[model samples]
Target chain A: MTRHRAAATLMPLMSLALAGLLVVAVLDLPPQSGLAEPVAGAMDRAGVDHPVTAVLLNFRAYDTFLELAVLLLAVLAVWSLGRRDPIPARPVQGPVLHGTLRHLIPVAVVTGGYLVWVGSSDSGGAFQGGAVLGAAGVMLMLSRPRELPMLPAPLQRLGLALGVCVFLAVGTAGLLAGHGFMGYPPDWAYPLILGIELVAALSIALTLVLLFLGGRHGH
Target chain B: MATDPVNLQIYLACGALLFVMGVHALVVRRHLLLKILAINIMGSGIFMVLLGVAAGGEGGVDPVPHALVITGIVVALSATAVALVLMLRVKAATGLARLPRSGPED
Candidate 1:
């Protein structure tokens, strides 16, 4: 009873302390007057409509490209980790869960595609979509681990390389168009963004799924 | 009080809450999956803050931060994938779900 009383008292005190700290922190923040106005104004002056996509594929194309490379490296790391290991048998779990997951997989795949498509103008995007699709693979592993497909080494490499290849190819195309590396030829900007995003979505989803599988074959 | 900065305050507060929750999760959760989720939450918190700052106490939101967050989401997933693989291997090797501990052993 005494310990319970103490715990009850401590909880409120902790909560109060946290609230006070939050209030102080909020108060300390700069007044929201003149933060990103200049940058927004500049974007307006430059006539860079669809600034979000423009910034993604044009202004910061190199960063996005490197990000794809980073994902590829991650896939490679997972592959190396599981190398030379014999595939293990799947764990035995219940049937209801398995059936439910099977149903969910197709829904997830469709949702992922939708996200990639709508990402052009909306909050959703390739990464979000890719992650959702990757979750489907996780579901497969969890529900029917025995049925997991073996990702051949070559295909694994291809999955990892797909995004980077698309990004680099587009960058190269831009260079040939006299726009220099990673520059978007003004007319092709939307199409290139769409293409890069689509490929990146697939590559990212595959890499994530493979990671969950530990790059191993199911025995 | 009607300067109408409520939206800004709310966003900033949400960001702070997310950051704090993420920190708590990182410290307390032993599961690798939970840890990765915590990290993503932290990234999202930072993203919110960036967007809030970019909002600039005005109507138009900044596109730069939106773009940055998009890139960040991808990077976060990449890291998550690698971490999940490592966790699976660890689970396979140790038959334990949590991280390995360093201690004086027999």
Candidate 2:
């Protein structure tokens, strides 16, 4: 693609002006010092000590659920486009890649699990865990580097739907119980969130890996 | 919003800088991949602005914005992945890496 010389020259100038305006706008902001009492209470009610996790899975679970849906939909759109050329265009066996993946995969899985576990109480969460797992999948793909489906069709489909379905089901169950959508019973909040995170992590991990793989492999 | 207004200003400025750079890239770059990268940069900038603004609110670093940023990162990646796939498809079907300046409005 030939570069557009005029646009290229103008861009930096325009960007600088925009940056200046943003800097000016930011300078007017006021600082906050402490957590408000009501917010602190909401954190407590979230069943998770970490305020961020509380917000993600409790106060605004709908957002997280929708995020998962978006991920799944992205993969579906890719699949709908039809098959991808086998990765590498040329198949070459790499003993080096195998050696690295052989060790790296276990670490990825363990770290992913650890992140998911710690998310409720600390900085880690489903997205981070899913990323680690997805990274492992990419490592696997590098070693295998095939156009063929590494996973069975049914499993791929299942993974794609798993997170969203679990989320929706729980939300619906809450509604049935008259607790409002995605509102867990107070007594069950902790376990419910933990379980949902685990399942959502699995779905996210698989969906991401599939999307990266590009096109439908698992017929 | 930020707990410290100084940090808030710094972060929002950073975000703004990134967004401007991304917009520049999107306009100036001819490659599809570069455009996608530019979009991701813009997304990150927006996320930074979001967190920066929330951190400066009446209450300290609010959970809501933090969660939203986290969600945004994941969503951004999903969108980038899809965009990359689309780019690849376009390339495969046509020999060009990007649409011609005046293609049929893809």
Give the per-residue lDDT of model 2 (tens digit) for A131-216.
99988886676566455556777877998899999999998898899989988887788999999999999998898788877874
lDDT (0 to 1) per candidate: 0.72, 0.80
Q: Which candidate is the best by lDDT?
A: 2
Model 1 docking tier (incorrect/acceptable/medium/high): acceptable
Q: Give DockQ per model, in order.
A: 0.35, 0.51
DockQ of 1: 0.35
Q: Chain A only: TM-score of every candidate?
A: 0.74, 0.87
| Residue pairs in clash, model 1 | none
**Global local distance difference test of model 2:** 0.80
Lowest lDDT sum, 10 consecutive residues, model 2 chain B, at: B97-106
Query: How well does candidate 2 reproduce the true complex, by DockQ?
Result: 0.51
Which pairs clash (backbone N, Cα, C closer than 3 Å) in model 2? B1-B52, B1-B53, B1-B54, B1-B55, B1-B56, B1-B57, B2-B55, B2-B56
TM-score, candidate number 2: 0.89
lDDT value for model 1:
0.72
